[model samples]
Every structure is written in structure tokens, then in C-alpha cells.
Target: MAELEPEARDRIMDVFMARYNALHATDYDRFEDGPKGTDHDYLCVSSSGKAPLKVQHTRAWADPETEWRVPKDVERLIVHALQRRLDERKICDRHVSIRVDSFPPKRREKLALLEKIWMAVEFGLNRDWSNPSLQRLMRYERNDWTQFYQPISPYVAELEILERVPPVQAPALVGWSATGEEGDGVQDAVFRTVEALKKKEEHYRGTSADLVLVIDFEVMPYFQDELERIRAALAARSIDFREVWLVSQWLPVSADQVWPAPNVQSADAP
Candidate 1:
């Protein structure tokens, strides 16, 4: 997983605050980046002149190892390698997007993975597009782009190939999944959430301001059950935080309150 750029991080905080204000009927409208090397990420101030809240954002990863592996770097490596191959072959007929399923852990295996992906792309290009079943998968409205699903390659899980629209200066590989693995469901979410909370609890102990732990769900899939499971897990432990929120990265964005469990009210509950 890549570190969020400052602008991107601020934008996510803005979205979370918007949802938070609407849900809680609070007027938190201003935000400032917390001092560098501090315990919190941002200081949020309300219109009512209430004390600024110390907010810290931590993303929940389905596979925590991604922080070190850096999946985005792998995607860039694949894209650059594929583009170079296309240029070498002088084959600029279409634009393709690849969804990687898995990449080998070892360096030697990764080199082999690139070759396998190119082979899969070449196979997809030569595929009979006029076949009835294949034609059904075409996006007629979107430049007649056809999808090729997992073409016998362990590396390339999906390929979206667009043809007969417009010739470009170069063929491009446009999209890839954040982490190729599928979500492990609510239990995984609960575990990750608890892990994030515990990590933050240890780091930011005795901070004066109210803490808002925002669990980013961009890399991890979101499920309704995750909310209840997180609430239950939090109730079982004694953690220090004024609020806990689950924020989604997808459209129609949502920030769900997960702490202050309805069944187990905190002494500080208003």
C-alpha cells in the first residue's frame, strides 16, 4: 500500500468530517494539519468554538504486509514492462487495463510474472472477438471495449481491451486493483480494526484532545457486519478514543460511527 499524499489525505479527512458533522449534528468546519512528528494527524475545529478534536487516520489492510510490499510499485512495474514490450513489438492497436490477481513474493518470481502477463495480453489480442459470447461482454457505448477474463495466466486476472475506436500514440495499461487478493470477510475486518486501534492507543496515550480514529476502508472491503463486529471488539477492550469511524473510499462515500456501542454506553457518552 502507498502512503496517501498530503492532498489526498486532507481530502479524505474533509469527506469524513462532512459525514461526521451531518450524522452527529456538530458544526466541525475547519481543519489544520497536526504538527509534524505529533501524535495526531489533524486538528478539527467546530463553528461553535468547541475544543479542537485531535484526529488520527489509520487504514485497515486485509493483508497488513502490504505496507512493506507496496502493491502500487508492483502495478507500476507491470505497466512499464508491458508498455515497453508493446513499443518493442510496435503493436499500438488498442488500450488495455489489467487487474492483477497475485504477484509472486520473490524477486526472481516477479520477473517471470511480467512475462506471463505479456503472454496473456498477446493471447487476448489474438482472441476471436466476433464470437457471440465475447461480443456480449463488449461495451458498445464505451468505444467497443471488450473484457477478457483471466486468460490462463496466474498473474493477469482480468484484461479490458478496447479496439476500433481511435488510434493513440501509445497503447496504455490504465488500471489495477489496489491489492489483488479478495477480502477475508468480517472477521478479518474486526481483526484489522482492533489491531489499528491498539496500535494507536499505545502511541497516543494521555493526549489531551478528543481522538477520532478514522479506519480507512480503501484497501479493505467494507461490510455492514464489520460495524457490529468492531463495536463488539471495542466493548471488550479498554481503548482511549472519543469516537471511532469507518470511512469508505468508494463513491456515495460514507463515514460510519463504530464506537460508543449502543448496548455498552461509555461513562463519557453525552
Candidate 2:
């Protein structure tokens, strides 16, 4: 169903979490402590950083702000919370993430990023969106930049943590929307995928090998087409991903990055 009630959505998230756990053995839990104003369905974290449970889901993408954008106040609230965690030595070391099951499709990464730059300019010149908290939001933007809320209207999105990976290289967080129908089929996949690359490009400064975009088989028919578009998108930017897994088992249907990404482990294989 396109529009699911809150309860139903939570249940769907539960099912997905179960599939993820079966494959990766995770101890998932309901995420209650959201970033103050937003909502989340589940959460998880790991100190080891290897396969750390990301609070964000692995299903298709939904945009809460498709029609109503997230207001500036609410956006600041989200930013403040993320910045707080970014500075927290404990959370960073602990590996944290806040997942969302529903939300509006993300604005084009290029456009959304340009908007962030514009907001920065607003604060830089003391124009609109000049709250003091926003100033703090900018202070730690690099450490924990995310796409939780877009300014103007409120829309639910993922609140992933950028827990640093190693002393030499920093941790990079990735947000993905594998739902093909949301973006008019393969084109939007290209958009979201490239948008992700753009964020990493700007943040990582040309070298973003640590960056990854986990896509799924939400739109099964266009998997190959979407994968091709993603490849083209990466080539256009002169960047590559850490890896792209075919997250179909958790989805309604089954698919892989191009075909079936080896489901090598049997349910009882291990």
C-alpha cells in the first residue's frame, strides 16, 4: 500500500528489521528518543563500527515533505540534536543511528546542498534562518551532516550518525532511497544516488571511497536500469561507492544490484 497508517508502518519496519537481523544477527529495539521533534520507528548502535546497526531503514524512500516542507524551527531542532551527538565522544565511539520508515523524497542532492550553502550564507550575513542554534549547526556540519529535515515544511527522514571510522579517515554517513516509483522510475534513483555522491564529494574532497549507498529492489523491474544509471552517476562524478548491496530480501520482492547479489548464506547455512 502507498500510504500506511503509523501502526502498520511500524509493523512493516519490524518485519524488515527481522530480515536484517536474520542475515546479520542484530539486537534491534524501538527507537523512542528521537531528535526531539521528529519521529522514528526503530534504532540500533554498535561500538565496533563493523556492520553497526544504522537507525535508518533499508527499504524504499518516502518523503514526508513532498507537499509540506519542514519548517525552519523544526529543522534547527533536528540539527541541534545531531550536532550534539556529533560532539559527544561517547555516542561517536558507541556508533549510533536513528531510523525513519517514512518521509518525503529528498530534494535533489545538488539542490538540497545548495540550499544548505544558502542557509549558511544567511547566517554568515545575518539574514533569514539566522537562529543561534543554526550557528552551532554550522559549526559541526562536517562532523555530522545529515538530511533529517528540509527547511520550510516538516517531512520525516533518516537521522543517521557519522561516527568517525578511524583516526586517519573520518566516518561518513549515507542516506538512500531505493523506492523506484518515488522518482518516476530509474531517473530518480540516478538523482538520489548522485545526490549522495555529491554530498560525499563535497565532504570528502574528491576521495570518497568510504562512502556507500545501499539500494534495494523496491521497483524490481528497473533494477538493471537503475544500477546502470547509478554507475553512470558515479562515473560522472569520478567517484565510487564502498559497496552497493541488493536489499531485496527485506523488501516486498527480491532483486540484486544488477541481478541477484549472492544470497550465499542459507537460513541454516551458518
Candidate 3:
């Protein structure tokens, strides 16, 4: 795969965002030319203006969002975009594609993964690449690499291979992953909720009534020790869990029905 031309990168994002707006009509609205603190080409929000979720703006997939393994070409676009953010906090929206930073290979690799391990974990894109319908979220037309969204797909399936979601005698935890991967800081996330509730913080009103934790597959190892503690605390609280899903692992589906992806072979990459 060759690096994404600046034109291709922008177009790809526009297509995904267009779909995003159509799907999240009530929940989000899209914007261009970057919003105040966002510093990216696109921004969207719900909740009277909150962080946007997938379809995560493509550039964001390289920033506050976790990084994934990408083909060399598309990876170049991400590097170029991040440089603008790290340097001037400005992105040129015209004819600017196909630039890979000249960092030592190791340094670039570290930077690529740096955006990961933040809070949420992702999987499944590669799993369904063989399916044509899933192609948009998995294989890229511009670079034949993986496609991912920030905030994860709200529709991802949660397969509880082991631990069951705790009934919350408490409220859902009120923090993003401090470390990217949810399990790494699962305890902190839980304790944060406990503290807020104990203090009777009005802002946390009604949280004590339920706890919803979204754990990612990568966060699994971190849970090896603390999952039990979390379960015990929630058990004490008797909060009913809303849902527990393994995100990005299964073919996507919305509240209405599952989306079918077209089956395309790797040989089909242009």
C-alpha cells in the first residue's frame, strides 16, 4: 500500500463522517475547520458538546485515539497529521498527503503505539476483513490497512468469556481510561466512582444506583488481579449492570439489526 495522498485521506474521512452523521442524527452533528480545542479537521458532539466518538475522525485515530497496525502508506498519513498537531496544532486541509515523518524507525514505532494503551481497547477489524460488508471498517481503500474509530463502535458485541458484569450497587465509573487500556486502571476507575458517591456529590447524582464498565480484550490481562475487587464492590452496592460488550470483535450491529460486510480477498486490494 502506498501512502495516502492528502486528497485521499480527506475524502476517506469525509465519507466516514457523512455516514456517522447519518447514523447519529440525534446524538451528534458534524463540523469542519476544527473546533476550539480539537485541532483536527472534523469534530462532532452530543451531550451539549462532549468528546466525539466513532466514526472517529480519521486523524483522531492517531491522536487521543489508540493507534493500530496500519500499512506503511496509510501510516504515513497519520504521522504527517500528528506532526502538525504536535508542532503547530494546525492542519492544512488542502492537497497535503503522502508524508511520513523522518524519525528513526524505532522512534516512529513507539509514537505509533503511544496513542494506544490509553483507556479502551479494540479488535475485530482484521477478523472480518474477508467479508466485503465489513471492509469499510477494516481494510482501507487508500492503503489496504486497518480501519478503526475512536470511542469504539457503540454497537460492538460484548462476549463475556469469563467475568460477568457486576450488578452495580454503585454508579457507573466516571472517567476515561487513564492508561488507554481500561483494565490497566480498572481499579482507579472504580474507586473514582466510589469516592464520588461517598461524598454525595450532586454531580454524581444517581450513579450509585448502577455501574457499567466497558472492558476491552487487551485490558483483560490487567483484570487478572483487580477484576474480583471491582466485582465485590459492585456486588456490595447491588447495582444492575446495563451491558458488557467485547468491542470491535464482532460484526457490527445497531439497535435495529446487524450490518453485513462484503467479502473481499486481500488480493482485491487496489
Candidate 4:
């Protein structure tokens, strides 16, 4: 895995602190970069004048080697290209969904594939099923938007049109691909989290401030039960971190505490 730049690392810490504060109802305000050669990554301070915490952030990947195999920028390129075509055609009333089976590695091939997709969508929209029998069948199954299956290439597989319920100022395209490995993904998540914990333990050992390990689950698939298994695995190992947090950077963003055993009640508890 490549090392995170100082600025990039700070951005991750910023998001982590925002979510952490919301989750725990704490007043942590900001963080600063730790001194060079220090064990921790940043020193997070609280607005309420509590002791500052030394935070160490790390990312875990199911398969680090293939994490960047498909460049996200390419996906964005496809969306933008299609959006421009939609604007040119005055298709501003609905939305589009694209399911990609694979993407060509070459740039020219990708551009060609995009053109074919737009042409197919255009043709499908203007096509008139004039046969009396077919027209009768269409009346019964009328839809707000048209759908098309364009086998443009091995790269681009399917294209679907969706009617905007409330209508929109402009049409939008949502693109997705099946990039996850087949499985429940619990074991992979657990293995990645545990590996990250082990690697950070030595770096944060014997530190005066509290140690925090933040695991990124943006690409890794998991659920609540996966968190339980991860917690159990970490608790069995002797580690240095005071707390462990799992963070997701995608939509419906979340930050969860997986350490300190949430079920373990304090002796002074009521």
C-alpha cells in the first residue's frame, strides 16, 4: 500500500473527528499533525479542554493489490460523456442507469464504447413500433421511460432509462459495476481489520496519549455482525490502542466503535 500524503492524511482525520464527535457526543474540535518521527499520526484536541488524544489512522483493503485495478476516474469519464450527450439531445426529463460488465483498458476503445451507447439510446428513444399487433401490446405495457439492452461491446453491457418522479432540472446518469468478490465478505473484512491492528500496534506502543485505530471500510462489504466478529478477534489479541473505530466513506457515511467491548459493563454501573 502507498503511504498517505500529509494533506490526504489530515483530510481523513478531519472526517473521522467529525463522525467521532457525533457518535460519542464529544466536543473534539480539531487536530494537528504530530511531530516528525512520532509514533502517532495526529494530536486531536477537544474544545471542552479535555486531554488531547494521539490518533493513528490506517486503511484496510480486502485485496490491496486490486484496489485500484479499475480507476475511478475512468468511471467518472463515462458518466460525464453520457451526460453531455444527454444534454445535446435535450434529454432533461429523466435519469439513466448503466450496468457495466467490464471496461476496456485502452482510452480509444472506451470512447468508442461510449459513442455506441449514446447512439443506441438515441435510436431506442425514436424508434416507432408501428405494427398494429405490437402497438396493441405496447399500450398494455406502457411505461414512463424506455429501456434498452445495448451489447455495445464486451465492456459496456446494459443501459436503462428511468422516469424522474417529480421531474428534474436536468437528466442525470448513475453508473455502477459489480466489483466485489463473491462471498459474505465477513471473513475478508475481519482479516483486513486484524492485519491493520497488528501493524499499527508496534508504532503506537508505549505512547502517552490514547491510541486510536481507524479502519476504512469504504470498499470492503460488511454488516453489523461483521463488526461483532472483528471486535471479538481484536479483543482476543493484546494490543496498545485504547479504542478501535470502523469508518465508511461512502454515502450514508458511518463511524462505529468496535473496541473496548461495548457489552462489558463497568463494575460501578447501576
Clashing pairs in 4: none
lDDT of each residue in 1-270, candidate 4, tens digit only: 245666656556667777666656677898887787776667889978988877777777655433544535346657777777777767755556565545677778877777777776566445455652331111101123334333464444445555444556665554555243246233477888887776666555556236777776656534556777877898898766778877665544556677766553211101
Candidate 2 residue lDDT tens string, 1-270: 123356644544454445455554655544322243222223343344444343322334333232113332333434444444345432222222232222334446424543443343234233334443332222212224444234412222333222232323333222323121244333455554444344434644644344223343242323444666555455555444443333433324333332122253312111
lDDT (Cα atoms) of all candidates against the true structure: 0.64, 0.36, 0.29, 0.61
Identify the runs in model 2 with alpha carbons over 4 angstroms from their true place: 1-5, 8-12, 27-42, 45-52, 57-186, 196-270
The superposed Cα distance between candidate 4 and the true structure at residue 185, in angstroms, equals 7.3
Supply every candidate's count of residue pairs whose N, Cα or C atoms clash at under 3 angstroms. Answer: 0, 13, 27, 0
Top candidate, metric TM-score: 1
lDDT for model 1, please: 0.64
TM-scores for every candidate against the unseen true structure? 0.66, 0.28, 0.19, 0.59
Q: Worst ten-residue run, lDDT, model 4?
A: 135-144
Candidate 4 residue spans exceeding 4 A from truth = 1-29, 33-41, 46-51, 63-71, 92-94, 130-153, 162-192, 195-211, 219-225, 236-242, 249-254, 260-270
On residues 1-270, what C-alpha lDDT tens digit does candidate 1 reach at each position?
135787667667878777676666678898988888776778888878977878888877645655425466566677778777777777655666766555677877777777766765776566666643342222211223334323325555456666533445554444555344344223377887887777777777756237788888776455665577778888888667888877776664556778865443211111
lDDT of 3 by residue, 188-249 (tens): 52453343233332433554223222222221212223444544554576332232111111
Supply the TM-score for candidate 1: 0.66
